[model samples]
Target: MTLSSKLSAARAGLFRSLGLMFIAGFGATVAFDAWGQIVSPALGFANLSPHGLAKSLLGAYGLPNSDFAGYFVHFYLVGLIGYPLGWLFVFRPVWGRVVRRGGWLLGAAAYGFGLWILAIGGITALAGLPFFLNFTGITWVALVGHVLYGVVLVAVMRAFGGR
Candidate 1:
């Protein structure tokens, strides 16, 4: 294929893959939240919403209902929205690399390092609210959460590839 054709094909792949990922991620988040709302409440932690983290970090700037559910919904939506972006930085270059493998690591690194540490934390800090100080304690949980997100993305992508 010509350069233009190759670029167009790649763009198509990115769009198609991103759309699939977004739908899958959104469904997963909704299901997880459903379980939390229905089952977790019986266990404990009644205080929850779909915009928790966003509320925690940007709560002052926005409305209320600050908790995990809130954060999960917003987080999944925004994260999936950036799906195609992974292509440019992670999966774009592969022309007979001697290694012949490792896109998952590249993509996961972009997710964990770029989005998790830099984007998530940076956005929270940039929100410029006093509540951010509270995050210091549970920051590790949040970090691990993003790492898990990276793993989820890779796994989901592999599964989707099979279909």
Candidate 2:
């Protein structure tokens, strides 16, 4: 192919990958929120409010502590962009290299577990909360929710022909 044609194809592939990531991320985030906010509460579990953590973080930084701000940060910034990009650029690639014969599901699960550590262990500390939320029930719930997020993310990506 000509140089210009190769560059055009590369650009197209980049956009396609990004589009897949965005859609998969949005879907996985919905699954995570549904479990944490709706299903868990109905099943007599604590209703997780991840946005609350975002609100606290915002307030700590002298930003507005409104629900809108919290939800925007949690859903849009982290869910749609951060986590998906992590999977696309970091976890998936590393897993592919480290475990050549490993299944994608397991890799995705591991990624989810890492996300839990990042959020519960790391982000909570940044927000001035106990690491892993002091290992409370909500901590386990968040773990499950994050794992579900990863599974759903990869599943959606695969369903749409992503590697």
Candidate 3:
């Protein structure tokens, strides 16, 4: 492919990847939430859900905890941040490798792990929240949830001819 053709292909692939990202993000969030609500508490977790996180942050600001706003923020971040970042970091890098020998499932799972690090290690710290607490189930949930997200995202992107 010519330089222009390559660029066009990449752009098209990016849009397709973003669409998949949107779907995967929401799916992951829903799974995470359900796990937090139904499973985490039984496993001795408290306020570990995304809604709980948002509620905590809102409490810090003396704002009321709104589930609507929390879900909106969750979905918005998936589309606005997750899509572009996934394309730039995950999709492009995975495809850019000349060898491209790894399975898409592995690549996507690795990408999701990276995202979990960024979210838990970076975002949580930046937000002044404890990265890890006494509870470990939440940690496992986040890690596995993100991995599943990557699996689904890669499956969708590959189906759509991304990379």
Candidate 4:
């Protein structure tokens, strides 16, 4: 192909990949939220408030802590971009290299577990909360939610013909 044509093809591929990532991320986040906010609560588990945590973290840094800011950070930054990018660029690639078999589901679950660690172990501390929320019921709920997020993310990507 000519140089211009090659560049155009590359650009198209990039956009496609990005679109897939966003879709997958959104789906996974929605599942995580549904379980944390709705199903888990109905089952007598603690409800997750990731946005609230986001607000607290922002306020701790003297930034805007409005509901809008929290939702935007939780849904747009982390859900639509951060997690998906991490899956596409980091976890998926690394998992493929490490497993070399039909173990994407397990790899995705492990990724979710890592995300839980990041949130409970890292983010909570940053937000000035007791580390791991003192290992309360919410911590365990969040663990399941994060794992569901990972599984749903990979499933969505796979459905959309992505790795």
The prediction achieving the highest lDDT against the true structure is: 4
- Tell me the tens digit of each residue's lDDT in model 3 across 4-116: 99999999877776676666555555555565566667776643565555555555667665887655555566534564467557565865594377766767777778767
Off by over 4 Å in 1: 1-15, 27-50, 56-76, 83-110, 130-135
Query: What does candidate 2's lDDT look like per residue over 1-163, in tens digits?
Result: 9999999999999999989989999999999999999998899887899999999888888999899999999999999999999999999999999998879899989999999999999889888889889898799889999999999999999999999
Candidate 2, which ten residues in sequence have the lowest lDDT sum?
A: 39-48
The CA lDDT of each predicted structure is 0.52, 0.93, 0.62, 0.94
Off by over 4 Å in 4: none
Q: After superposition, how far is residue 78 of candidate 2 from its true place, in Å?
A: 0.9
Candidate closer to the true structure by TM-score (higher is better), 2 or 3: 2
lDDT per residue for candidate 4 within 62-157, as digits (tens), equals 999999999999999999999989989998888888888958799889999999999889999999999999999999999999999999999999
How many pairs of residues collide in each model? 9, 0, 0, 0
Number of colliding residue pairs in model 1 = 9
Kindly give the stretch of ten consecutive residues in candidate 1 with the minimal lDDT sum. Answer: 87-96
Model 3 residue 125 CA deviation (Å) reads 1.4
RMSD (CA, Å), each prediction: 6.1, 0.9, 4.6, 1.0
Which pairs of residues collide in model 4? none
Off by over 4 Å in 3: 1-20, 31-48, 54-65, 79-84, 87-99
TM-score of 2: 0.96
The TM-score values for the models, in the order shown, are 0.53, 0.96, 0.65, 0.96
